[model samples]
Target: MKTIYLVLPCYNEELVIQDSAIKIEDFLRELVDKKIISAESRACFVNDGSNDSTWDLLEHLCETNAFLCAISLAGNRGHQNAMLAGMMMVKDRCDAVITLDADLQHDISVIPEFITQYKKGYEVVYGVRKSRKGEGAFKKVSGDAFYFLMNILGTKIIKNHADYRLMSSKAINALEKYGERNLFLRGIIPSMGFSYTTIEYDEKPRLAGESKYSLRKMIQLAATGITSFSVRPLHFIFFCGMFFFLISIVMLIYALVVFFHNGSIPGWTSTVAPIWLLGGIQLLALGVVGEYIGKIYMEAKHRPRYEIDKVIWK
Candidate 1:
């Protein structure tokens, strides 16, 4: 039997930590009882510097539960960074690691399937949602748009898959080599070209408290994923510029012909309209280029992804 470690990244989840911890501990015990995993398997909760009493609750849980451990970041480092911190910390300690949300929205029941796949020689197992039946209207639309954009932009990723998945020690070690400042795990893992598989599972509703991913954060995540994985957006701007340049050449020819035939230029509206349109296009192009530049700048700085403030284990 392999030792499995569950890495859950949490931020401001005080409302659901205690209950979620109990449920997760029970599930781990059940898996052990069934001989699905080793008795030494552990659940590692990562505190992404939550302002609430989430870390305190984790300390209390760790004191009482042998299977539960905790990692606290120096400060809130976002979901991706916090998850990376926990997984990197425990990769050497476990045979495989499974990452999921602290809110229990990721179905814990399918975890056995992940281990089964790992045992069957799949190094990376992605937990893909079977359907978005329960998502809000805005969430559904935005999610659809993000995936659509990713597809159109030539980013190879498993649609409808979040950060919930299992990674064997080998796969996790391979992941540690990637030093992307703008981290997008969903896109990066597929690009690894490892022997991977997907498990379809139904996503459950949040156990408690509202979701931390607000609209701003969602957009930020999408942008990071896009800029990190695909250069097609930058190429798109170049193509648009070439297209407008061709149009301008044709318009200039028409204007010269009209000026020679009637001794006057084209209408003011025609000239002004294109000026305004091209101006806006120029600004949009600059903004897109700036985003890429910003990524390069951040990467050049070579900052640490996260810092661990404390860790607890028995």
Candidate 2:
């Protein structure tokens, strides 16, 4: 009799919260009735300070459903932070925890498979999307490119995996030890060195509300993942500096020779070319360094990842 917790992070998902709750409740009921999990297994929703009635709906569900629980964050502390808050609270109470978006785009049916994988000794089970049928071509292509770049940078993140996944109690304990303020769960999960497996499923369209992750958010997330886990971008800057430094020396030598042989030229092209190129390279290098510095500054603050403003339980 093992308890399981499904943690859903919500932000302004009023349109989808009720339906998602119903489906998750039904699934948990089936698992409990079939003896796959204890009756204590529950679905916990973390409301990320949604402006709408999302938290209210979650409260109503918690009142009516014995297996439903809800937590409201002090503010909209991003999706990853909210998920971290919920998981941290329930890790001791449950045998395993499954994290998913409130939109229900990730199939809830995959939970049973995630549980099966956990039973098979995999501490972490990733829900990898086999196909992005509802996403636009731009999103699909950009998503692919992001994972490719991360892999090339030595991050080794799972392809087609979002924040939807399962973590056994052992895995959750390992993750809890990582106290970095910038919580990139997907990037950090593989770093735990646990036995892991992937469950593939086709992504479905949102049942009710629009996606909370916009183009800007996606770009920001990619940047955070890169800066948080890999230093290859900084290394690339070093390589670029070395390359241009060699080129500058060659040009300087060639210029000196030309001055001794053919004298000086009238046009400013030669002077300006090196000036602009060197300046551009220097700025790019500084930018990469600044990115790392920014992360360091954030970590120095030692702020809590999330603040729980409220909690509702039966």
Candidate 3:
């Protein structure tokens, strides 16, 4: 039986942490009893510097339940970094690791299929949402747009997959070699070219507190995913520049014809329109380039992704 570790990244999830822990413990116990997973398996929660009683509660839970443990970050390092920290911490001890959200939005029942896929020699197993039927209009549209944009930019990501995935020790070790600070795991993992498979699961609603990922955070994540994986945006700017140059050449010819025929120059509207258009394009291109430069700046600092303030294993 393979030893599995459930790495759940938690922010301000005090409302649902206890309930999630109980459910996880029961599910894991069932798996252990069935000999599907080793008894040494554990459900590890990474507390992402939540400003609540989350850490204290986690300590209590770990003390009472052998299946539960937690790692407390010194500060909020965001979800991706917290998940990375948890996986890295437990990689050596577990045969495979499955990542889940503390909000319980991802279907935990599909976890057994993840293990079954892993047993079939797949190092990476992605849990993809079958549909976004239950999501709000804005969320559904944005999620679809994000995946579509990623595909158009050739980012090599699973269409409907998020962070819910199972990675073997081998896959996790390969992932550790990627030292990027601006991590978009959804894209990065697929680009690693591992033996992988996908399992479709029905997405569920949140069980407790509001989603920690607000509109701003979602936009930031989308931008990170796009910029980190593809330079196609920069290439797009280049093509736009070429197209505009050709248009300018044609306009110059038209102006010369008008000048020769009517003995007059173009109107202010024509001049101002081109000026504003080019200025906007220039600023946008600069912003995209600046994002890449900022990523490079952060990565060059070689700072730790997260600092462990406390660890509760027993």
Best by lDDT: 1
| Pairs of residues clashing in candidate 1 | none
TM-score of 1: 0.97
Candidate 2 local lDDT, 232-251, one digit each (tens): 89889888879978987997
Question: Candidate 3, which segments miss by more than 4 Å at Cα?
Answer: none
Query: How many steric clashes between backbone atoms does each model show?
Result: 0, 0, 0
Between 1 and 3, whose TM-score is larger?
Answer: 1
Looking at model 3, residue 289 earns an lDDT score of 90
Q: In candidate 1, residue 270 scores what lDDT? A: 62
lDDT of the candidates, in the order given:
0.93, 0.89, 0.92
lDDT of 3 by residue, 126-181 (tens): 99999988778999888888888998998888887879999999999999999988
Q: How accurate is candidate 3 locally (lDDT)?
A: 0.92
Residue range with the least summed lDDT across 10 consecutive positions in model 2: 265-274
Candidate 2 lands at a TM-score of 0.95
**Which candidate number maximizes TM-score?**
1
**What TM-score would every model get versus the actual structure?**
0.97, 0.95, 0.96
